[model samples]
Target: MLESLTPFETVLVAGASRGVGREIARILQPNFTVKALLRSNIAVNELEVLGIQPIMGDAMIPEQLDLSGIDAVISTIGGLPGDIKRADDEGNRNLIDAARKAGVKKFVLVTSIGCGDSVVALPPRALEALGAVLEDKEKAEQHLIDSGLTYTIVRPGGLKSEPATGTGFLTEDPKISGSIHRADVADLVCKCLISDRANQKILSALDRNQMFSASEIVEFIP
Candidate 1:
C-alpha cells in the first residue's frame, strides 16, 4: 500500500475521454477537483456526470490547452492506427510545454513498457509490431524528463480491461515486462501523483503473477 501525502487539490487530465486517463479522472474526482482536456464535446456530459469538469481542448494544439489553475497534470494520450498526427509524442510535447509555462507542480505521463530502456523486455516480434509507436512514446518520455518539472513516467506493460488484480505494482527495473489491468495502472498513477519519492522517476508497471519471466522482482513502493 502507498501512503498519501499532501495531495494536489486540482488536477488536469489529458486523454480522459477513455482508457487509463478516464480511470485516473474517475479515481481522483471524489477527493480533488478534476478537469479533463477533451478534443470533442462527446464526453462532456459523461464526464460531468462523474463530477469531473471537462475542458474542451486538444493536447496537440498548444493554444487549446490552458493549465493555469491546475495543480497537477496527468496525460495518457496516444495515437490511433490511422491517425495523421500521433499524440504519443507531439501531443505530449505540447502538454509538457503548457505544464512548464503554467508551473504545474507535477506531471504523470503514462506510456508503454517498450519505451526507453524497457525495450529489451519485449519479444522481438512484439517490438517489430510496435516499434514506431514505442519510439514516439519514448520521445514523449524524454520530453517530460527534460521539461524541468517534477515528473513520473509510468510505462505499463500489455494492458487489459479487466478489473484490477490488486497484485499490480511498479518496479524501477526496466527489464520487467507483463500485463496489468487498466484500473491497476490508474491506481499506481494516483499513488505516484502524491508520492515525493516517485518524482523524476521512470518506472514500469505490471502484475506480479503476469510477468513474462521468473526473474526476481523488487517492487517500488511510493
Candidate 2:
C-alpha cells in the first residue's frame, strides 16, 4: 500500500498560473499550505478559489523571490519558443539560489526526460525538435543538481494534459522514457517531496505501460 510522510506546512509552486505548476498546487492543497508564485495578477483570483495563497512574483527576476519561511519549492517553470534568453535555464537557477538562501528543505524541479545525459531517453527527431530549449533545460537541471540543496529532479517524458492515470512511475534508468499525464507528474511530485528516498535523485517520470516499445514510444506524445 502507498503511504505519505509527515507533510510540510508551507509549499510554494513556481509557475502556478498554468500547466504542470497549477496541478502541483492543486495536489498539495489538501494537507500543505500551498503558495502560488505567479508573475502577474491574472491568476490571483483563480488560485484563490482553489484554496491557494497567490504571491505576486516573477521567477525570471531572482531578487523578487522572497522565499523566507517557506518549507519547500516545486518549480515547473519553462521557457517559451523563439526567446533568445530562456527562463528554463536562468529562471530556475535564480530559484535555486533563493531556495538555498532560505534554507528550504527540498527543491523539486520538473524537467523533461532528454535533459543532460538522459538524451538516450528520447529519439533524435525529438531532440532536433527541441534544440536549444532542451539545452536550456539541461543547464537548469545541472544548476539545481550542483546547488548543494536537498533536491529531487523529476524529468518527465512527454507531458499530456490528461487526468491522473495513477499509473505514473519514477526510475533512475535514463534510457527508460515515455508519455505521462501532467496530473500524474503532480501526484509523483507530492509523493517525492515527503519521501526521503527521492532526495537528491534525478528521476524520469513515465507511464509504466509505455516504457518500452519502438513503434509506440516514438509517436507517444503529441
Using Cα atoms with residue i matched to residue i, what is each candidate's TM-score against the true structure?
A: 0.96, 0.91
Q: lDDT (CA) for every model shown?
A: 0.92, 0.84
| C-alpha lDDT (0 to 100) for residue 163 of candidate 1 | 91
- RMSD versus native structure for model 2: 4.1
The candidate 2 region of ten consecutive residues with least summed lDDT is 213-222
TM-score of 1: 0.96
The local distance difference test score of model 1 is 0.92
Regions more than 4 Å wrong, model 1: 1-7
lDDT of 2: 0.84
Candidate 2, number of clashes: 0
- Per-residue lDDT of 1-222 in model 2, one digit per residue for the tens? 223345468999998899889988987887788999888899999999999999988888987998998989999998865777778988899999999999898899998998887898788998898868888898988898889999898889889998889888887778877899998888888778888888888888888765655433221210
